[model samples]
Target: MRTRVLAASATGALALTALAVPAAQADGGSGDIRITKVVVDGDNKVTIGTGSAKTFSVSVTATDDSGIAGADSFTLAGPGYGFESTGKPSCKKVSATTSTCTASVKTDPRTDYLSNAMAGTWYVGVWIDANDHDYVWKDKAGSFKFQRGSALTTNASPEPVKKGKTLTVTGKLSRANWETLKYGAYSGQSVQLQYLKKGAKSYTTLKTVKSNTSGNLSTTVKATADGYYRYVFAGNSTSGAITSVSDFVDVK
Candidate 1:
């Protein structure tokens, strides 16, 4: 069973009718059950969009003198407070007394109708039981980013221009708006314009442009050779990073 609770942060008890979860305790363990490490979504970034649900994984590593029996649940609490993983994770034993527990989680905003407040810092809570009747419960086991999805679009005009002529490039930066269930302009953000020769294996940064009040971008560059142009946004605290599709231009 998954438990969803609303809390400003990861602390205190979560009282649900007929199921009173104890106040999250730090390093809760009995006789050698130890939570060694916790990792979220590998790099610790969970990006979700308005179009579809996003899925990620969490791994909890623990050790006990008597070996691990299993875990009760894994709670993901953040700005909006999140999902609780109740089923046992895919368990792999590393040694006589240590095991790594991993589980996958899916997040869909449409189902919950949660607001943008869900994007921010998040924490993980864990409960692992040991083979010898020992158990461990730890809140704030690990932390990760829960960010809103972002997108970038690029367009380069004058498909074929003189070698010395000027070419214009334009694009827009937008991010998912949880409240409206749509993408909205992301203004006042710096996005890098990049270029790649027709057959070049990679792209190089040409210049950086800041999105206007309307989240629109426009820039000009001298045409030198056949190449592709695109815009890349590094993103910020609330939004995920993105790169625009490259637009190709032929130089005469």
Candidate 2:
């Protein structure tokens, strides 16, 4: 009877361990240090549109054998990142051994925070200042990546996009215009589009659609808000930069 009870307890322990393994992998654990929670408050990861700027919030929690000594600070590092807050970041101390921090900043509205949302992925990290003014905090540091936006392949002439009204753009390849050079250079590759309205100070991605191998693409543009926008397409050859961009629509 004692043997059977011991066996039952062992089975229960195994079951609990099995249940925790997957979670541990997903959460990312290094030895004894573990990240318990990371909460980013926002409807969309990357918010770039035709209106006001977007705001985002980040909440972090970490746990180790000794718990967190105190979070240093947080940073939004990558292309096209902006903050409305003034001065330096303020670290929030949660407990004697643990700490938490947040990032409340306004971001561009036309972009999405996805792997393919924009040009490249952005790194958002949290750091703790153990010595108060020390630049490098090895003991308290954590980071995550957020894709800035999607690849854009657009085509526009010198025409200016009108505000309050819809602007229609049509894209087509020059006859026999596809050519290849260094990095498997060619014009038959897939393309994407991003644009901003004219007269506005900032640029926003209007739409992200595909283009045919023939280099024909089009999308309707409307500004729920007003701004000067320069349209750019993603079709540059990996080998080298081209003298002329086939996918540029200056909206003004």
Candidate 3:
């Protein structure tokens, strides 16, 4: 497999990159190779946390007088991220001329090859070689996007509190760091505190708080009724917004 290292901006934008395609065989005729479908992580959306792995499945329909030997290899490439092998696909013979190939891809921020990959649209490519002849075919498989995700946690101590007593709420905020392929504290960001009555249709924001140096949160509110409390993070360009599961507090 070929390898290259590139860098991305803070916003996850990629720099210029290229892929090298082998020259076609001079005498061998091009075979009929078609990429019917391509699915990444079981869908078109290719979302990955920092330092994560994803699998891809490609369906190929090949028709030729000569028998199909199946796919030779598959590749996933995009802006911010360069060409990385999905490894050789495992093809299952459906008939003399048709087969399906499945493969997996890993993005490790620690590894130099994929350390610069940003979250965005990526293109897939496939190569096929015929068993009966020197004929080979290479074509585009499909496209998908890589997106960052945020993590949030919340806790309300002394769950059962007197109606007029102060209820303490605490939480943390973090987001995927593609450079490290891990979730790190997201500090100095605004997070909303919301509350929902036991049977209410929706939650209403009570106040907004900024995450501290360690991404920790702490605040207090008067206990008035039975309801649920949660924190919502409004994500930025590089990451997607996420909300913590509601923590219930019972008021006497």
Candidate achieving the largest TM-score: 1
lDDT of 1 by residue, 85-114 (tens): 535587789999999999888777666555
Clashes of each: 0, 27, 3
Model 3 lDDT tens row, 1-252 = 133335554677544444443353222346555455667666555444654444445444455455567666666666653566666777776667666677776554445444424566666666766676634444455776555668999898787999989988999998777666678888999999999989999999988989999999888888889999999987764556789999999998
Residue 25 miss distance in model 3 (angstroms): 15
TM-score of 1: 0.85
State candidate 2's TM-score: 0.32
What root-mean-square deviation over C-alphas does model 2 reach? 17.3
In candidate 1, list every pair of residues with a backbone clash.
Answer: none
Span of ten consecutive residues with least summed lDDT in model 1? 1-10
TM-scores of all candidate predictions against the true structure: 0.85, 0.32, 0.58
Error of 2 at 38 (Å): 3.9
lDDT of 1: 0.81
lDDT of 2 by residue, 1-252 (tens): 001111125345412221111111122223444444555454214422333345667666654444454453444433322211212344455665345556565553323221122222333455433323322222223333332222232344335445345656555332110111011113354333444434544455556545466445566765344333333444231111111233434434
